[model samples]
Target: MSTAAANEADAGGHELRDLVTGLGRAFGGALVFSLPMLMTMEMWELGFAMERWRLLLLLASSLPMLMFLSHYSGFEATWGWKDDLRDVAIAYGIALLSSTILLFVLGVIGPGMRAPELVGKIVIHAIPAALGALLGRSQFGQSDEEEEEEREQSYGSELGIMAAGSLYLGLNVAPTEEMILIAFRMTDWQSLALIALSLLLMHGFVFASEFKGSEATPDTPWWSAFLRFTTVGYAIALAISCYVLWTFGRFDGLSFSTALGVLVVLGFPAAIGAAAARLIL
Candidate 1:
């Protein structure tokens, strides 16, 4: 081959290799991040027992979130809406395949199961698995340039990231019975204290810590950051927590007080997740 043709062939080979490596990372991330949920009994039961409409809604809602996440940080560097959409599709596909294989290997899925049960189980788990696949680039493959770009994101994009983080962590624990049991055991005063703690932790994680991803600066006031990012993030966390709970039918017949307690309980972790999102993602 001529020199120019040889160079062109090398470039093509490099591109193909990078694509394969990214796909492998995405698959690894999907399995690693979702393994806990895959093994959880509640998650397994929720797959088949949850309402069909709720399941569909969960699946539909994940698409936009995945698209937005892909825009910010995907399995590959995306330049436009088309790229983001393609990444979302790839991540979802990886999630579905990974979930099915793991569930089958674990004996959670089998030959005798009905279609809805089998599909439901896989679909429900795929939401978080897809999120993990998209996050693979951010967590395991982020370049310095990408990190800098993320740091320069707008306030709205920052909030979007927080919401994504909140949903990711909330989904992990939302399907469990322990959330309700903890809420039921706590007193009203304890619930209030938990809310205060969540807010404080959320604020501290982003603003007070000297972590590498901390957005705070000497010139920026603590209260300013608290009000702008921390409080808003906590609110987003609560909203996401409520939505996850509702999606799982956890609030179907509960009273106002009980539901509020459960919301607060879940919000604790979600709030922390939201705060840490800026640092981690």
Candidate 2:
């Protein structure tokens, strides 16, 4: 075959593969994501968490990332690492925004609801996303399960609904003071945790679905991938913390509480990614 024809054939092969992966991801999420809900309702006996319920409503609400990521990962794997990283950034970014939006909507719709408390629950719950990101990242450079894990290791902003809540709480009453005080509130452990858990769950589920693929790859061993993901994420987080401290850290305006609060809020996704890497990857 001519060189030109050979290249074309290789390129064609890649496109076909990505199409398969994308379909696999979308269809997989569609099939499985809702499984958790039924188990959740049965487990907790709670109603669906959404604007309204319809058959598969919550799953319908959720699972785009599943389709997106499966296709995303499959495409990336078939295509290149750069694409995979881009997918991760986009997926996580959307996740962060969505969770923040939901918190506000819930706060507004449920008058009796304690908004701050709701935020906290979200962070804790999102532990999964952290798992997934790391899980996904770990796959980037890894070895297959054939090698035993010789080692072990571990480890967004803003919706006005939050602003309105702050006002209701007290900050909103005034405007300038409210903004600053509300910034502090954003750092709260509760708010921080909720964001963390919420992001974690979304990503975690996606990563877990892909876990099998990573392990099957000769380079990607399960435990090592998890440990590596945690280390890398923590390293990045630390560097960011330092930058924040150097820039905003000194001012009394930015206290430990604020820092911790921000970390928890932002770190929530990291936690989820790391966990997913560790557990699922």
For this target, which candidate reaches the highest lDDT against the unseen true structure?
1
Candidate 2 per-residue C-alpha lDDT over 37-58 given as tens digits, one digit per residue, 9 for 90 to 100: 2223221112223222321342
TM-score of candidate 1 to 2 decimals: 0.95
Clashing pairs in 1: none
Q: Any runs in candidate 1 off by more than 4 Å, and if so which?
A: 143-151, 208-216
The 0-to-1 C-alpha lDDT of every candidate, in the order given, reads: 0.88, 0.35
RMSD of 1: 1.8
Q: For candidate 1, which ten residues in a row score worst on lDDT?
A: 207-216
**How high is each candidate's TM-score?**
0.95, 0.26
